[model samples]
Target: MKFVTFSHKKAGHHHHAGVLDGEQVACLTEAGLAASVLEIVQGAKSALDKIRGGLTQAPRYALADVTLEAPIRPGKVLCSGINYKGHAEENPNAKMPTEPFFFAKLPSSVVGPDVPVEKPVRSEQMDYEVEFTAVIGKPLHKASEFDVMAAIFGYTLLNDISARDVQFKDSQITIGKNFAGFAPIGPCIVTADELTRPDDVALKTRLNGKLLQNGSTSDWLFSLPRLISFLSHYVPLEPGDLVSTGTPAGVGAFQKPQIFMKAGDVVEIEAAGIGVLRTPIVAG
Candidate 1:
């Protein structure tokens, strides 16, 4: 099942949890099943069973009648860095890490599909990275790889928008990656049972209709189990916490002449089976 958080056009600005069935969405809130995606995540299997059994009776809305929001408001947006071999190889300065190199993007930075991401006046080299993100379903601390697999709730996509100038000048990554609207996530979260091949999913990024980054999870240097387990040992992940696997190559800063997003440009990121997450660039 594809789970979503959305606001109906005629229903004011309130957000609701929903299940998507092609072009139609069954409103879980309207059906009295769940109030938010975080509730469903924490409830685990019982909540899922309820959503599946009562789907037919839920209020339905057309895709065009509502706006999609990030699937969940996670407590932490944990991200892996240089986990893709191609991405590591592309950057002359990057040394392949023996362990998962992780970072955090503020939850406030998150926006939904079709939202506009601001090109902050402080940056000149804005870039795009499409990552496959996992949503944790249960708690984990010093977990085994096998346990990590069982703890996954679903999969979603995240665009790691960065400000290269700020990143390099400040000599840090967090501030550059945490601008407002920088972490655009979701069209919907495809439940783990629905995405059987999470390790081999394909990913792509297009800047203004031109395909720039084309790679797959098959190229990942660290597998999902390896990454999650490593993180759990220190972070003590909880339900609704996100684990965003890093991107493959083709970021703008590495290009020969360099390329950066400006106002009016749209960036579309696609993760096979999960659907496209589109973000428009706007002046800060």
Candidate 2:
């Protein structure tokens, strides 16, 4: 069953089960279901059973009449860099790290679909990275491949927007990835069971209706299982933790002329089964 965090036109806010062919949303509380998406994820089997039962009797609000929020309140956001072969090749001088290169984005950077991607006035070279993000369902420490596979709750589309000028100027990438609204995380999270093969989905990015980056998860140099196993070896991963798998090669910085985002541009990131995340670029 699909789940969401939404605010009805009349009611202030709450979590709900997305239903009725995507036209309606049923409040989990009113339906006597789990209180939050985290609760559902923690008790997925029982929660799903309850949501399904509620579908038969709970009243639902029109989808158009509610505002949607990020499906999960991530405890931490981990992002991989140059994890795609082609993407690594795009910058010949930069050697691929022997281990998975990772960075963190503050949870405050996340925004839902349709939210504006505020352009920080301090930077002019903002760019986008389209990637698939994994949402963790269970706490894992030094997890094995099997444990990692079992711990995945779902997948979602992620736009790793970067402030290139600041990114390169500093030795670290944190400055580039941590700007407010830099992380556009969701249209909605697609549960693992809903996907045929979560690790093989196709992903792409578009700028103002023009396709820019097009690639598949099959191109990942470090697969999800490896990433999870490797990361858990260092730090523990908790429920709702997010790991963005990395982007393909067509980023603006790699273009011959180098194209960066400007005000009023719409950026869209899409991954098969995970849905699309669209946001407008505007002055900060």
Candidate 3:
């Protein structure tokens, strides 16, 4: 099922978790289920099954009437770097990581679909990384592949809006990738069972209607199970902790002449199973 968090103008900015059926949104609350997406996720499978059943008879609204938020309000956003072979080849300066290399984004950095991703005036080299992000459902530590597979809640798209200058200049990338609106993720989260192989999904990134990056999880340097198991070894896998599989090659920074995003540009990250994550760019 495709689960989402949305808000309508009539309800103000306060968001409600619901399921998107075609162009309609079935609000979970209408069926007596909890309205908070985060709360539902933390409750795990039993909670989701209830929500799924509720969706069948829930009151629905046109999707356009409500604004979409990041599918879940995650506690931490952990990302992999240069995990795609093509992306790693594009940057000859950095070595291909032998193990999962991760970074974190603060929870506040998140925004919803169609939101404006502000380009801070302080940096003129902001870039984008379209990733296949996974949400953890069950807690785990040093988990096995079987364990990791069962722990996955679902998959979604995340545009890891990056500030290239700071990312390359500073040794640490967390800050450069943590700018407000830098982590725009959602439309909806397709539960793991809905997809046959999350690691084999196709992904594409378009900027202002021009396709820039296109690749599939089949090209991943490290698989999803390895990423989750690696992360679980250090941190307990919580229900809402987001773990994003890294982007493919076509990042603007590695091009003949860098192609960073500018004001008034529109960016879309689309993936199979999950839908598009549309974000507009504007000056800070």
lDDT of each: 0.93, 0.82, 0.86
Across 186-209, the per-residue lDDT of candidate 3 in tens digits comes to: 989888889869878889999999
Could you tell me which 10 consecutive residues in candidate 2 have the lowest summed lDDT?
Answer: 12-21
- Which candidate tops TM-score? 1
lDDT of 1 by residue, 113-225 (tens): 99988899988899999999999999999999999888999999999999999888857799999999999999999999999888899999999999999999999999999
Candidate ordering by TM-score (highest first): 1, 3, 2
Q: What value of lDDT does candidate 1 attain over all alpha carbons?
A: 0.93
Model 2 residue pairs with clashes: none
| C-alpha TM-scores of all predictions | 0.98, 0.94, 0.96
Badly placed stretches (over 4 Å) of model 3 are: 10-13
TM-score of candidate 2 relative to the true fold:
0.94
Global CA lDDT of candidate 3, please? 0.86
The clash count of every prediction, one per candidate, is: 0, 0, 0
lDDT of 2 at 228: 85
Stretches of candidate 2 off by over 4 Å are 13-20
**Model 2 lDDT per residue over 1-284, tens place:** 55677767566554554533367777775666766777777775666677777676766788788877777778899998889898999976679878887889899998888888788998999999997988888888999887787888888878899999899885648988889998888777777888758668888898999998999889889878899889998879998889988888899998888989999999998988766788899988
